[model samples]
Target: MTHKKLILHVSLATLSGLMIFAPVATIPAQASSVKPSSAMLKKSNSYYKKHYKAIAKKYKFTYSAQTGLNKSGTIYVYEKTKSSYLKKSLSLAMNYWNSKLGRQAIKVGSKKYHTVTFSVSNAKASKSDDSDAWWIPSTKKVQIRNSLYADDLSVITNTTLYNSEKSLVKTANANLAAYKAGLSTTDPDYQSKLDTYQQQQVDYAKAAFDNQESNLKSGLAIKAREFEYANTLAHEFGHVMGLKHSPNKSDLMYWASGTNDIYNYNKVKNSSKGFSLVTSTDVARAKLAVKVHNARN
Candidate 1:
């Protein structure tokens, strides 16, 4: 089957075939050179350090005073709250685009920052009455609800059941360690156990996906909130990149924001073999946007 059709088919199944796992990229060699601005307030700098430091190093871009939050050339990730998910999600979203669209040079900040500024609001403030997140095209700012800090996916990943799913994630690491100990010389039952663990891992992932969806729909604990928020940021960023929602529900830019498809925020996070990042269609459009943008400027 064609690649696009395959994705649609997999997405339609809900949880039958797992999406292919993309190998996580290694941190850039000189991770220390990219220092974020201390002036930008955040809940913790650790998220920037651990998740975004590498991207900053690789891209080496910052907010442009020239553009002045014009949503042209360079995009700034302003943090409205101290939510770690917000920080990580914005950084990941930017990095995802940077990979596809090519990086832009920045004129401000220390080394290069994601451009964060916390907005304190005591009153209940959200993008709209019906939405959890939205990107304001005119303001050139991405506003996320402050509640994102508390109702996040990490809550699930830190729990016992979540740890079992995590173990499935670590199974490859375990097998690698065993092979390093001496492949053929390793414990004979290890391979059998690894196989069993692998299957159990898939089962756990499927179960986790279902449970997370139910939780999302029923207003229960958010099982994959971090991943969902990251996807949300990516989706909105697609708007910022001058792209519209796709008719294909499997695409990240699907119009309904994953309400009915496998790309549903919860399902994609749980069912994607590993890191549920944006889809190929999203990347392609972003690349086109960047190309047209660069040509005009």
Candidate 2:
């Protein structure tokens, strides 16, 4: 055999091995440095330190009708008397989780925040109406109503708001005192429990996906388009809450879903919808109805 032929054969074998076992890249070491914003940092530090003041409170993730608005927190879904679309969506999701979806994890805010979804009647059904921007204050963090909305916007780790959460949040923390007392990160039981917990989350997501078809076919698709904020909802609830869009192209939050799907926009019907959070560019052209209760004088 020629030396050149032998070299080609070796290359093919190496390529085959790589195809069989693709290597995983290490998660970036400076992952924390991907700071959302500098203003967010300064505002968050001052807000948390001042209001929470040495709060060792821990949050837990659980399936409860009490999602987002916990016993200690507040989240209200309201519709103004005038906007029909806003009324419909709020009415649609009012008690949506009384069944299976209720079994899924939900975002929970701290006790301080009076979490609310004030659906304005004159405001139309637009989720981007200027009114809703209060939920996600732009660069200005101090103006945020509570620390939960401003600082503790659920990002990386999903925590539950249960009684046993104090230790749950600290479970990931490598406390020297616990290590010195004999607790080890390598304990089989600890590893096993963590694996089961993570697997449960994946399983729950799979179940959620299974219902996606039905959800899309039903009132949700109409609501999703009429409101024109499915992307915002998915981005806010899923990504901000630590879930990524599946590799599948069908999900609305797909990284590449931006080019405007041929199916969604073509058939989306227009309704009596207004905006709660308008894009910065839109704020100049259209006047949105901000809720009377929440209006800034």
- Highest-scoring model, lDDT: 1
- How large is the C-alpha RMSD of every model relative to the true structure? 16.4, 23.4
Task: Please report how far candidate 2 places residue 292 from its true position, in Å.
Answer: 34
- All models: lDDT? 0.43, 0.27
lDDT (tens digit, per residue) of candidate 2 on 1-297: 000000012212231111111012111122121212333223443353453312211111111112223232223333223545434533332322212123322332233443433322222213222221122212111111122212211210111112113333344333433443464677768766566665655565456444543444554444443343323332223222222222333332232222122123223323334123312211111111011111211
Count of backbone clashes, every candidate in sequence: 1, 19
C-alpha lDDT of candidate 2 relative to the true structure? 0.27
Q: What would the TM-score be for candidate 2 when compared with the true structure? A: 0.24
Give the lDDT of residue 70 in candidate 1: 33
Candidate 1, position 254, lDDT: 54
